[model samples]
Target: MNSDTRTAPLACAPRTPALMVQGTCSNAGKSILAAAFCRIFLQDGLRVAPFKAQNMALNSCVTPDGLEMGRAQAVQAAACRLDPDVRMNPVLLKPCSDVGSQVIVMGRPVGVMRVRQYVDYKPQARDAAFATYDSLAAEHDVMVIEGAGSPAEINLKAHDIVNMAMARHAGARVLLVGDIDRGGVFAALVGTMELLEGWERDHVAGYLLNKFRGDASLLDPALDFMQQRTGRPVLGVVPYLRDLGLPEEDSVTFKEGLPGLRDGVAAEGGSEEPGTGPGSLPDILLDIVLVDLPHISNFTDVDALRGEPDVRLRVARTPADLPAPDGRMPDAVILPGSKNTTGDLRTLRASGMADALARLASDPDGPVVAGICAGLQMLGLCVADPLGLEGGGSEQGLGLLPVRTELAAEKTLRRTTGVHPRSGLPVAGYEIRHGITVAAEGGEGGGTGPGRGGAAFPFLLREDGGPLGWGTHGGRVWGTSLHGVFDADGFRRHFLDGLRTRRGLAPLGRVVASYSLDPALDRLADAVRAAVDMDAIYDMLHLRPGRV
Candidate 1:
């Protein structure tokens, strides 16, 4: 079999070129490298897509086809301007509650498998990985794949589906990435090769040194030494850009939330990031408010708003703390996600914020009050949290959206893609929620509807083979168990701009929604590809014809 082989793709026919990012170990920038390369390839005018034959990261996403995958590739897919689907991330291993993993097969949870059970299922996992690779390879012009952890995890190497094993199986050209800033960078690379058998080492064509700081020439001596010892080329060094403002895929990168406002520190003008969006503010100077409850998740939703030139975002610790808003109430109020619904609801009610939220929703100004995930559920009338039921009691929602929600035995975890039927527009997102919210009759029970105490509707409805009035969802002022709804920059720009306009502020007129990030990505990818010795990697791995 020619190296670019995939079990699923062979079942079809493929025509795309493939590349892989191999890491010296975890946090070696493998996912970033893949993302950058996809951008680079797209900049080259190719219909590029990103893929990771297999990945194991705590940061995960659900695919459009309803499969669960790592969030890293999903972020890269956003950069590549492609829909995040199962084919983009074929194999997903999510660490479920604890020792158990909710194994996702082809965009659906197969079952909970323990580590030992997963070990026994390695071959199946790999076969599934190849199947995913094939499915994606058949569609695009270029596919950038990513590897997980060090290629040399000895204990886990036997059953490894990432790194050289998958690369060898996929016949992908390998560009190994090494973190130079990490001490023992040389040993990390050389020792990794020494630890690997001849075939394993062969797939790495070159090595890219990432996160390098200071002068490049000063490190030339060490670079030359690595080249001489391992005979692999040191491609280029990537200088770190502070606050690159990209959405991070894993918790390791969550620290960006701290430096400014996330830690609750006020910036030069009161608070830099307490609520302002990512990068710079939007062009409009509308003051927006967010209900800063206790259990915040999906904080990334407002990250891109920081890039605008004229918007100010603030978090409301209490109703009394709500911004005076240029002598008027806020143009909009956003209810972000929460990890604990019942607990947060209680906190809201006890803190008097719930009453404040209800008053705002009822305000005749008709300001848009947006809620996401648990935030969306909280906008409803009642949250039937079984956790509270079993542990003592339950809490009532603010009744702003007119809906009722309850926790279910099983969680809905997977990628949700395609047009948001309610909006009839392309909205890419995924769902990971413990609670299943069903729109209830809002008549006398204080449920969600225009006439009820609530101001907005709960969810969007689907009009397909599903029912009409109440098929899959309900109305706007909606919430799905989905995260990464803002992954699509266009949708994000539109939504934020709309909210800003509603607040009586001007929009960032025709700002570029699709940022051509490939230039930045290519500078990164070429550096990675240039560092590792391709000829030697292919030779060591026995990936050349007749070796296997």
Candidate 2:
């Protein structure tokens, strides 16, 4: 290694206590662990915030002040009972292709670049990240820092701004987390430490073994060996949590299995069956198929819907995954958000999924077709990218709605509250997109009417008296730009009730409570507190028991 690239200790410690959580690999539970620490610190009466100098995720959220950041940081902010601030995650890299990504600095897009180009731009990115970190550290009593990928990536270490480099910059104690569920926990931990430089090794205060499923005592030998080998204490062995009820950070969760479907099936006594059978209750279990787009984003929008007792959610990646001609048709079809509207739309068209969706919407007795954000844009007459914002092109849409969309340079990001005029229920969500959609001129069902029964109507009337979405075919084919529209308990129940009424079944009524993360956060904190040595963690930070 070059002398200039050699790791060095911080010149002075940060006044505010900071703890950094780095992982042995991607999906080693770094984000969740950071969130748990945020909650744990908050419960102990100390002000805490989450920070990640850089994040690479397509799944994102809009802050109350209209800035965009990684969804994981937003969840962590919720754990701290604070609104998400862009400073918490300064640089966000959204991959648009295998070798290129759209770099977002301080929650705003700069430009797209290839891997080598981004590496060249690391100096400026590092400056922005350090500035943001300094500002946040000045305000919060403690900051829980999360790292991207592994610190042992030697090839990228020289330009690294997210892993051990960031830990050293913040003068934070490092907690290296390894996934026991992925096996090779011992080697992964030991190898990571062996790969780190001397100063980086000094920063590592302890080790955390995540997703441990077996007896804790069974790990005594291995834990002892790891501590002796690395000279760091084994702080925790977190249990494998099931149905954690928290939104995932990205699409990696899909690779393991469809998340909501597994829980829904287990809820029904492990039945793989889809719908209600003979002599079943009149409350029909509605099958809702979500089109898994090539660049799907904000998939957590449908998480609330999946938790409903009368809903069965499934992901459809291709035409074959959709309902068969001879098979039972789904009760509803959802086109979720996408990062690349034009690109993903082209893929869907090429894969014949577009044609299948057209057929479903055309069938009078077919399922309700709904779309969100980019999915809403795709359901329109066409999507045009005049400036080549989405790789510079235009594509024909499914023509399910009488609207046309044009990609714009400026993205709309804001928290929105509105009301569903049909059901008179309050609705709230957020908007994060770069598309401007308007009604088609001289087209049938193109007029903006009241949000009520009609061939075409507004989906919602915003609190500011503006229309947010459109619907056609008397609301059978509809879409909205809002991301979390279905999270409202009353509106979600009403929407599901509409599906039930169409199938000649009774509404299940509002038996479930509104969704909240407090219980889940508390449960997670309790688990970590029980399994981990919290006193040692506090002592590492030089913090006493009462408060900061």
Candidate 3:
């Protein structure tokens, strides 16, 4: 132990206790573990919060107050039974290309810069990160901090504001987590410790082995050896959770395929064909197809339906992936949000999905088509990027909706609550974009409301009576700027039931019940609490078993 790390009763700073969960590598369960502790602390009657100094991912969500943050922290906030705030994740890097990103500070875009240019902005970003952490600490009794990547990235250590720097700033007790399922857990854990600086090593209070499979008792010998080598106890071994149904922090998890209870299920179509025997409705489950655009953002909007047992969600990256092998059409097609709308629209066209989708929309019996955010923009007749916000040019849309969108210099960001104009059910969501679409005159080049067949009206409204997203009267096609409208149980069920009615299947009396990860949050926390030593963790943070 180092003298610098020694605890002096009088010198100790009195503030909210914080514990950091860092991983030996990226995707080593750091976010999930932080969430587990957040829920556990909240369950113990303590005010808790989740924090990440910086996050780099396309997956993001809007807070109730209109600030944007990482989706993982939003999930953790839900686990803590709290609304997500911008303070939870102060620095967000939304990658716009391989070498550049649109830097966001405190939930607003600062500017676009290359990776090298971003290094110079670190000092400012770091200051903003600390400011958010300090503000969050003032309101919560405990803060469960999550670190990005690993603290042992020696090449990037100097600009490391998210990990070791944050640990030192918060005086946080660190629990280093390693993934045993990835193999060589011992080497990864010890190697991480050896690479860290002496002060960084001193701050680590214990180690955790995550994503373990098989018998826990079989690891007793390895655990003993690790403790003997590091003088730190193995805090816990989290079992490999199957179908955990939590929104992932990034796209890596989906690289193999969507992580859900149905991983082994077929990638396309449901168990039964589109329809059942004669005089019987199709035995097919709800088949929802999602377009996997190159720069897809906020794809978590469809997570609720993906996890439902009766729903089969297929991610279509190309035209061939859209239709089933058995020649059955999907029940619904959803176009997700995208960071680069024009670029992805081009990709959609080149991949032949644009033509296929147009055919689907043209067929009277075609599946219901819906879009959110950028998807809504693409559904319109024309999208103009006058300022070259997303690469300069005007692009023709699918022409499914009679609207025109123009990308602007200013972005509209806000959290909203409204009622479904047709269903009359309440809906809540958020808007984060830099364009405005309006109804144009009929037969005008710019386009107007829904064309000849569909009636045009705003989809929802704010409590202040302001208009929100828009939808079509035909009900077969809808588009909205709201990113999380499906989060509302009533609206989601009503929409799904409508699809069922279109397919001649019986309506599901009860929806998935909970879609915001509430059930999975409790399940994960229970497993973690059982595996980890609560008493030791409390002692490490010098915290009592109650609210402050």
Candidate 4:
């Protein structure tokens, strides 16, 4: 659970059986497939764990022990009913820009490096990754491995430790997954097999066609051709699933133009449409706008809010995306976390969204403006990166909150639980950031004590009575450093109810019970199990039918 250091003793258990899911390209549903296998193995009564030697993503989760790792691995761990372990993802690359990324080894940030620098550091990264994989493999009966991007990237193959190389290291049976939904599935699968070296191709067991829609049977001819061409079986054709209620692996989901919005209409499941199911929808729909920053990170923080049946969540990318002064204003505005606070702040300003946000916050009846992590920093008066931690320089914030932030060398990663001061509701989440924020010189509510009347106050009080965030305008304008705050159902409901009260609508009593991923995981497992040949999967893993 602690930061991975070389001095730590390595486990010497025998190599465990493993199955690696490699994709034809990024977002080919490799992560979801690995997660389903994890759940399936667990259901069959085997000790299972998920691993990705190296991950390049801005979406991350802080483990209970205060370590950080890719969020996809964390989701897979949940599928196995296990807490996330850093060993599951030994190397994490969080991109701050197109050319550079913050290198995280063993749950701790080492430094930021450009592509060339990272390539030179790969030897060390490879060693750490192998060591961690060994440690995790020793603890589990079987390992479900996930490969990053594609294995056929000729430019990256030499330095690759996340795809075929990792599969070879683990002696894993590789299932090349292709997204049939993207078209050219046949070409993508055949081309990948052709590009891989003979030695690398030896580990290939078969293929899994993912994200298919309509008749899966229609793919039979292509499936047969793939098998005949590559001498590999097509194990499954998984149907495309919508609104699966699972966290996405990365920002590629935004490419389709704002999640939950297709052709300017809300998708099914938790759509903005009125709910006929019991207590599903509130009397009035609360429109929530989330500012889509250029380097938006942890966008999943708003997933819980987006799932509410009565809350309509929209992504606002420019000033024009915001509600006009004369039009029906949104019920709230949220600024999500960012990988590069100063950089995104500049983007907001250049696009005039910063000014728009400030105007909204200043309005007496404007929708509640809330911020999380970097968003909280952007709400302050200034964001300074004196050490060049975030490409250096400082930027003027939106000035909605009376605070200032300074980027430090060391990053903070921890799980937190607190009480919402206004509602006295319990809240739990985690913090992952490098900026240290404090009250401005003449800022109101500078003290940690409770607020007098309804003036500016701390957003949350830690279990030990320490304050966590700042709030003003009677809780209408607030920001917190904690991500996933809305996941706390009671607190989320209370906050939403407040919005209803402000709009003169009766509060909708608790509609649904608290949310849990167990049901969702089970549903996913069921669908995948029905689609894929579990018996063949077991044979690939050398696992028995009943147990390990």
Candidate 5:
């Protein structure tokens, strides 16, 4: 269609043929491998790329093009040094309710389509999937594709874009990854391979064993026996990187315990580090509770906190599930972003959390309650349902802050800049949401306007304007559409530092922004290499720098 598409032949693909790094199950380290491999290829000075045919998760993100896609694709894009775009992830299915989803095609929210309705939409989804692969393949020398949860899930095999079907369609080689940490790594690997039908089985170029604990020498014999029996290569046996920062796909990987890794207690609690800044913040444990609402998206917001030795965080699913801080009350409670705004609101209310939250917001001495995205919406005075416009019902909010949220008939998403007119934080992260919580009601003049950044004006009303869900008082309660808001330097520490100061604790000097993610990537690659066949991995996949 254009000059770039015309010479698409030069578009880079693995010279020896690209190999996929799919996992036996979810969180089997497939995403890490994708990012790590991209980083490794980038380190080798070659222009590498990443792709994922279909990623189904509430954890979504905005691409540089101002379109919505899954956050994992964003991470992989960062690893490969590419600007995030919806093309790399053309078909994004973000669920709005239990049985419904909002289908995003080519970076735009097309319509609120039903799941059952998508069954016959294959012809459309396949065309977009191939178009995306072709575009990415044309730009780089090597493309690394990440598959969805366990290619072995028998019932989910059809309408499949992440596994064998994708491999065959793209004419790409595949590598299966199984988590040894889950204990039946051998069975999982062999079982998955056994389920593949004919040609689908042939695309698998190799296999990788991931997340082994201590001592690889002990597993050598098992490795030998399996290699011979399965006729697949084991690339590398990787040890787990305890502090890796690759964001997780869902809450299934969540862990709860005393703050940080330590002695005598939690085997996974966390550990003592040098005063992670001023008056020893990372070393001074603070108890935290994360409100586990249904429809939660972008859990990565809390990843850094999870890695912190001083801050103890846990997910609490109900009003009675409140986790106390050490021997005292929780120091803070975070309401992470979610997809179904009105639904999450109703959940809070039905669970009797509505009364608990109202009391907490009114109590000056209660644990500080904070909400992000939909969590932020719940904290408002009122939150209305969007379905009502299409002729449905609505619900009231927790009313912690003066804000109110009204779900418009249309959803909104984009990448934009917001200077903290408020406090000690980093630069703008990114925003992805479907509803707007305002300070008041029915005051918005129009539903659309121009936004400063790549963002569209979805704010129900302007700052001076009043809409059904508008707000007045800010600081104590805050709402933003941005994700990764807490990741910017000084953002988390500065905020945590304030918490310490409130409790009369000294400020944690300088927060550690030098987390050194590159080393983590390299370490993961080395680990993945163990479960893979090294000789074949390099010989078959690695092309010198620019030689596609």
Candidate 6:
């Protein structure tokens, strides 16, 4: 079949030329490469949007209108200078387990399905994918499509809605990306091409070698040989970039969370194991520990903190994994978002971290304890899952925050922008959770019933008219259902400054360096543009190359 049959153009589509980035393997840098194209197009003064037919990942974001989509597309949208929309990621699969996931169609969860069951829904999913694609294509001048995993997964190619199938459906030319950092780049590129069917092979316009290290001259011979063998040119060789960070696509990002099992620190620094003594942690302006839940989601919430040179962050799966307070405890303890709150909470308690956190929170001079999403619910007095939404009926919480939560049938998804009650600094973040938490009847100590005594001070204001988070003056505990709360420089600086003060450390200057995605995106695009032939890419897309 030709491109017309594969990805039939929508009646209203703006006749925009599309290009697809497929990888030789998962984490082969397809997402960032697509983002590079998006930024490039935007810089050329072309309106652009990023597209992914389907994304299977726990990391997600809620659009301004309360629609959910994959975080990768959201990042790409930012690179394109556009607002993220559900249309960017038509079908999102948030895997709750190895065997099943909650299927989100057009930004709302319809239901959960097993791996086998989702196969039966592929035809319908493909249609939905095109519908969403057409919507964006109708508005933008260019669409940069990102493929998931590899296109050569022989077992999954028949029912595939991503990769080659997506390329065909979008009538787009494909650039196959392979990571040289993983080694065997030559074998991987050749093997992938050999595995493709005749039409699939023809759809690919060229090959892009990503994450390359060493001299470019050393790779010329192999590139020539590959081009001769597969008749596909090597478009570029992107050098191994340092400090180029982005939100990871899966839990693999937390490969560092279990440092006891792995050697060497990961690039993300989520894997450091606490040494035997207080000196195990390197001296830094501030230290923070994140409870590494079994099914942690949106841990990128801490990505911004990594930008603060004076801050040191670590992830702990158990109490013993935590660094010895060594008379100087961590400035803050963060409990991040979790896919399964009740289950992860049980894991937390089993690991003895929950009790440890309670003690820390109860200590008047202890580190500031903060929880987001599932972390927020875990701090409450009680949590209920009547329908067993997260694998429990009812469970006791850390009781650090005077609140109670119940997992409701519908999820609360919104992009919230508000001001911190105390800091009066503007803060913005998104909330994606199934629980509705309310003030419990308990007083300062935390009671079981609800009353005026149970009221807690709300710390975050919602643009839609609601309290978003709670904090206590005495306990130094903060809880919020909002994820990405740290992305805002004003709020993060204000919050971290409080911790710095509590720890007797000097506060930061008037302006703290804020974390942003723009510069990183520009760097990414520059790398790809310098390495890849824009003339060839423009030719592949049937467009004239603009001056670089």
| lDDT tens digits, residue span 1-548, model 4 | 11121111112222798999999999999998999999988888899999999999889999989999999999999999999899999999999999999999999999989999999999999999999998899888899999999999999999999998898788888899999988998889889988887767778788999988898877788877776778788999899987777888898986455566653335675444344553434335677888897788998888787678667777788878776233577889999999999999889889988878877777788889999999988887788999988768888887777777999988999999999987788989899999998877657432221112133468887889876788877778888999889999998888888888888877776744355677878989999999998888888777874566
* C-alpha local distance difference test of each model: 0.61, 0.83, 0.81, 0.83, 0.65, 0.79
Instruction: Write the residue-wise lDDT of candidate 1 on 196-228 in tens digits.
Output: 766665555666778878876798888787767
Per-residue accuracy of model 2 over 319-370 as CA lDDT, tens digit each: 8877633367788999999888999888988998888888777777889999
All candidates: TM-score = 0.66, 0.92, 0.90, 0.93, 0.84, 0.89
lDDT of 6 by residue, 1-548 (tens): 22322312233322678888999998888888999999988887777899999998889999878899999999999998888899999999987776888899999998888988899988999999988788788887678999998999999999999887877777778899999998998889888887888778868888999988889989889988877777778999988766666666676646544221122123443322223243443443477778887778888888887766456666777776565345456778899988888888778788888778877766667788888988888888878999877665898888778888999989888878887777778778888999998876644535221112234778687876687888764437878888888888877787777776876666674445668899989988888889989888886676764421
Best by TM-score: 4
**Clashes per prediction?**
38, 1, 3, 0, 39, 7
Candidate 5 residue lDDT tens string, 302-348: 76676554566766777666745334556677888877767777777
Candidate 1: segments with Cα more than 4 A from true spot: 1-18, 41-49, 57-68, 75-85, 134-143, 171-173, 181-184, 242-246, 255-300, 312-370, 378-402, 407-435, 440-548
Model 6 clashing residue pairs (backbone): 6-169, 7-169, 256-271, 441-449, 441-450, 441-451, 442-447
Give lDDT for model 1.
Answer: 0.61
Error of 3 at 212 (Å): 1.5
Q: Residue-wise lDDT of candidate 3 within 1-548, one digit each (tens)?
A: 22243323322443789999999999999999999999999888899999999999888888877778889999999999988899999999998777888899999899988989999999999999998899999998999999989899999999999998898888888999998998988899888877987778867888999999899999999988777777777989889887677888887776556765243244332333334542331345677888888888888888777655467776778777777555688889999998888888888888888888877877878898888989988888878999877778898777777767899987788887888877788988788898798765552322332334464457666667665655563767778888887889888888888888888878776655567588889999999999999889998877877845
The TM-score of candidate 4 is 0.93
- Candidate 6 Cα misplacement greater than 4 A, ranges: 1-15, 257-282, 324-328, 444-455, 463-465, 473-475, 546-548
**Winner by TM-score between candidate 4 and candidate 1:** 4
Off by over 4 Å in 3: 1-14, 261-282, 443-467, 509-512
